[model samples]
Target: MVSAARTATETRTTTRTEARRAPDIVAGVADADKLTDEIAATSVDPRLWTGAFATNVWGGRFAIDGVLGEGAQGTTFQGTDLKTGGRVAVKVFDVGRAKDWKALQLFDREADTLKSVDHPGIPKLLDVIVDQETGARALVRTLVPGESLAAEVKSRGPLSEAALWSVIVDVTDVLGALHGRSSPIVHRDLKPANLIRRPDGKVCLVDFGGVGRMRESAGSTVVGTFGYMAPEQLYGAQTPATDMYAFGATLLTLATAKEPEELPRQGLSIDVEAAAAKLSPQLRALLTKLTAPDPSGRPADAKALLAELHAIADAKDRPAAEPSWPEPMVDSPFAARGTDGDFLVGIVGVVFGVLGVVGAIIVGQLLIPLVLTIIAATADGAQKERILAARARVVEAAKVAQRSFERSAQHGARKLESASERERDRAEHRRRRKRELKRHWKDEERRLKQLAKDAKRSARRDGRFWV
Candidate 1:
């Protein structure tokens, strides 16, 4: 009996020990399962965890819906504000998975930049959060509505000139706003994928992940896509013109219905002019200059580019000036001739009437002189000398009157000739002006017709059904 009791006591002691260790084993198993889950989450694509993250509350208010997109930096989700029921875009930056320290800095830079910007084209930063459990960061912003410009171009082919112009103007205006800021911001990645075309036909810039301050020093890592990036950008040298280069490449793709990388090239530069040959010369030139391999060759800034675009649009809309001709001077042949004729006739008539009176007087005086001469012949030597002198003086006075009348008639004729010559010259000038104006009008008409024909050809080439 004593031996049985000892074995039983040992058995009881073992059972109590096993019972005490059960809770510890259970706790250890639970910890191992959690460690395994964490390892799986980090090892696989971050996208796989999107569903779990979407369900989680961000910034204690935003409820993520679904994955919108994923990029090298992070994953974006369509989300909702539980407080206001408004839509938002939640960008989660898993810093743990970042390739480099610069990526994390850029992600933080984008958040900081968005928080201060208040433009309509830019999404407003709503909230920022750091997932306590996973150490992931999230940025909540206003949901920008629209597909990417890249997708739109892919589905719709090349945009019409007007449509393309709208897109360019909208984007340029946005850039103007950004670059005009106190501390100008450069959108280093100004590609089609970063541009959002809203339903209202306005374009908004999204994904500011590649944005940087103009005054900031070049980053250690380049932060733009390959084909759209400027040469300087490849070396991490970014400026407003850097954005212009990307803008040019984006527009070139839209204008030609081809990807920037897929388009033909001329050495290191893109042959955009060749691809967009059917576009207007002004547009072609603008794109060419914007995409110039050298940054200096591009526009100085977005504002300058916007001005040039406005000028081009203004030129396109301005009506061509029609050839104008000076009104022809109406000359009445009878009136012109009659004016001179009447004056000449009046002067000649008055002169002739005066001359007739003078002649009569002279004749009368001659008769007197003749009578005097006769008297002289009958009288003595002294009376005959005086009568002969009086006759000679009367003859000389008659000769003077005839000379005066000839001089007056010649003056009147000269004046009439000068007036007629002036009228002739004026008439010739009017005829010449009329001929020149007609020629100019014909030339203008031909130019307009050629412009119309070229426009038609361009429309056909661009695959536009409506001109």
Candidate 2:
């Protein structure tokens, strides 16, 4: 009986120890008490939750790998979808520790906006997860694979003018789509950090935390980064023009590798002239209009802005006009110079003529005056004829040269057009091939997904699957 009692006591002791020593195989969700403790610890330490240990959420559908970034709304994590084994970005908002109610509202709005839109330059929403226990909400999205523009600029220095323009063009094109919707969406915060540059030079916009619809009622507090926000955005007035301002600010940052506010400013306006001095005048002017203190000074809409940008691009593509010959080179010598020099020459000629005529009359007989007159007339006529012939020859030579240049230019233009057409055809063929390959890969992906589903079902039927 003593031995039996001792065994029971030992068993109880073992059970208590096991309960105290909870497994650490998973992070933040190992045990309720541990998760709470971790949450508190992370809040106090300000260190990222690396997720070195697996964090299985939503019944192991997603396993967060590590923290990708921290933002005003929440923390974003690099994670993997267990079902498809595809990478995803997981944004988690801890409601319990939210700074204010506005954060929650912004989170909801972002989720809604993401769900409503579908574009290649934007992240696609995959799933939404809410933890009842910890009061944590998460958004799962397809990972936009690339480094942020901020990071790229930091490592590589300021982008070249062409590259910067291309970046802005890509961004504006994406914005055009966003703003073209019935209830246009404004990306309230547009900056280098929120823009991702892909390997193929495509830009992907992320962090819809400050996204707002046009005509939406304004909140009391503004939602945007200070350096990238428009003046009106400070008063919680957001529109497509507000985004234009942010884009302008972003361009400034990319061009100068400095914040908009850090650059020289003229009153409330950013001195884009000083900030982007190396950029084209058109780009500078566009920046000035976009970052104008008043909304009316900016482009009316994204479409108008796009048209202006395209116009600038077309102007760039066109060949420059041939430099015209200077007026002095083509005009008569007397016409080029002022009449002062001609007048002086005429005075000297008159004096010489009088001396010549007096000498001829004094040294010759009575017929001398008449002979001199005839000789002078003949000489003047020959001089006039020679001058006329020379002028005519020069004019004709210029015409011939102009005609040759015109012919050459025409032939060169024809060659360039043919080459451009051939290149366009090649590009189209490449696009077609790429589309076929994409379709084939998509089919393969679907088949693999089906196979995975079947395997999971088989495992469940065999009693080998565990949730």
Candidate 3:
């Protein structure tokens, strides 16, 4: 009876243990189902969530932090490169969307172009990603730290001449580098909005979406901003000069404190000179040449335009003879009353030798009278003749230097004239080409109209016979 009682107690304990384990198994299964449902909710529609992903870390690599800007092509996100822990600008294009096909092509083209070219003024392409879920493409580029030139100009009004010159020089250098490439690249959209001014006072060119190689065939669609685009570019013809035209239009806007499109237009051309009347004559002339109705009237290349710009700067910096010196010995190391006056004169002459005629004249005006007075007051006849001869030599050297400068200036002017002549010839050729194109298009239109009329007439005759 005791053995039966002990067996009954063990069976009761086993039943309690089994009853406790059944609910635990059921709860575990319920938890798993809940997890599966949550996962399904997250993964069901990538299109809805893909853009949201840009708010967090993307592709497990880029940490999308903020929206930098958006364009017609794609939205640019300011992000962190998780691999390198550096700042990056990620341009995301939803290729699954039908409207973004052209944008995808442009984004791909920009990436390819950036990969091929290297310039400090250009953003470096770092990485490219294709999301499997959404089929979206992302182009990662190094974040160029700066404000857009357009923004700067808008906020600050027109830039100072010095600031403007600096911007022009920086952009021209970049353009020169691009145009000098083996297969010359043209930034079809060379507008103020596409340029960035760094804190270090350097300007960088960005947005290669409209970049094109000179040798490539023209695209079917018209590209670039209307006011900034050259006449030929509107008809799918882009050349280095096209960029020059855009550059001119950009400058005009900056100088005039107005949008290129807002400025008065003469037929297809912007009246740049009238709009930018406040700018210097040289700059005004440059704007005219740059915004010429004909592509041939613009600078042949960036290098050519750069040369002209440098010449303008040189002219501005060229010293002129003043009636009086403004503190002649302000920064001079030589003492005015030194016993070794000849030594001081020699030093002045040495300084002038390097400064061309302007420096020589200034030094002469300051020292020659002083030197002559000293020689008259202290030196013997022989020393006086020697000092006078030295003065004469210095004057002669100054005249020679002046002649050389004139010759150099003349040479530069002649080169500019030659460029203008060449440009005129090209303009004539382009005009002929444009005329031919217009004629061909008109003829084709007429033919199409006639064919349509004939078809309508045939249909009418057939209807009458049926009646």
Candidate 4:
């Protein structure tokens, strides 16, 4: 009777374990259900929220229970502010030992500084809290609805003129708002990585982890990002002009994929600096101030810098129409910046280097007058006919040459397209082959695992047999 009673207790214990597991399953289901319901109720765009979580700030607590993006900063985590229970970002800073203290201090200051700003492009600062046990700080701010500009550039390659102009306007607007404040906010770090593009295509500046008020001790070192820092920023004060310089550098970056890190060093072929060439003279002049090697040469504040840009844009629209030539089809776009060969006759807009028919016409503009004078000076009809004949032949030859050059260019483009397609196909094939190889390797691993399992089972059975 005692043995049977002990067996009954063991069976009851097993039943209790199963019952506990049953409640876990139910509770998990309920929790999932609650989240799903909340998501369904609050989701503005149902098509977008299949797996995305609505960052909720309930009762002052910050909750970021959603997809953490693949940014360098482990910023994509969910957390809540203890004081306010507001949803906030818990970015894990992995600063190496060399600058750990300095980095943390900067981060704290950035959060505090952000709390003073009120801009649409900027994330709203809620609070900053460091876990007492872990020392991990959650810099709480409003969740921005956008993707980083770096991601956009990577996914979409380079942007168009209109798109770039629009982004520039936004950056200017944000800068205006920040600098216009009582205490100027300097985004010491203005690079593609820190700017986000919302669904509306407007830019939002983020990651104030590097932001500072005009007075913050530029934070322990030469801290601005390379290629994006104003020349003065590299070695001097972090003033408003320094920020403008960085802003220009950032714009240069968007215009050319090549970072400003490569700019100062690249001599002559500044084709990489074509962005400089493309700008109107006023814009060119404006950039000089914004990116001046001398900080004093630049505008005193962001407001002045923005006004300069606006003035340049305005001048471009109102400038006297550039002298147009009938020969090269000269228009305002070329007139905006004078060196187009399209105005000259005999010059072909060659492989992006030579301006073709345009060059020819401008030269023809001078040559035709000379030819006319020569024809009038000579009383010989035969000489006039010869000159006219020579001109006709020259004109016909130019037409033939133009057509030939165009066909050759078209052929070259087609060839390049074909080669690019082949290369892409080869790359895709290699990728697929690698995937197959991985699958085969995985199969071999599974086979080996099965063998090890069988061997262990056999050893156990043989031990029993030996016993």
1 versus 2: better TM-score goes to: 2
TM-score for candidate 4, residues paired by index = 0.50
> Can you write out model 2's per-residue Cα lDDT over 1-467, one digit (the tens) per residue?
99999999999865654343221324333355644344333332222221221134443577654557677787676767777777889887777788888889889888887776756688867777775545677788789888999998899899888888788778887788789998889989999999999889899899999888774345577889988998888777888988989998998899999988899999999998888898888889989998998988998668879878756754554335312212232334333333234334444444554444444334332344444455556666777566555545545554555455455445545544544454444345445656876996799689768866865574565332221
Model 4: lowest-lDDT 10 consecutive positions: 21-30
Worst 10 residues of 2 by lDDT: 45-54
Write down the lDDT that model 4 would get: 0.56
Q: What is the C-alpha lDDT of each candidate?
A: 0.72, 0.70, 0.68, 0.56
Model 2, TM vs. native: 0.60
Worst 10 residues of 3 by lDDT: 21-30
* lDDT, residue 233, candidate 4: 56
Better of 1 and 3 by TM-score: 1
| 272 Cα displacement, candidate 4 (Å) | 7.3
* Runs with alpha carbons beyond 4 Å of true place in candidate 2: 1-41, 44-54, 216-218, 322-467
| Residue-wise C-alpha lDDT for candidate 3, range 123-228, written one tens digit per residue | 8677677767567777888888889989988898987766777878899878987898888888899999999988897999998887777833466766798778
Clashes of 1: 0
TM-score of each: 0.58, 0.60, 0.57, 0.50
- Cα RMSD to native, each candidate? 20.5, 15.4, 25.7, 24.3
- Pitting candidate 1 against candidate 4, the one with the higher lDDT is 1
- Estimate the lDDT of model 3: 0.68
Using TM-score as the measure, the top candidate is 2
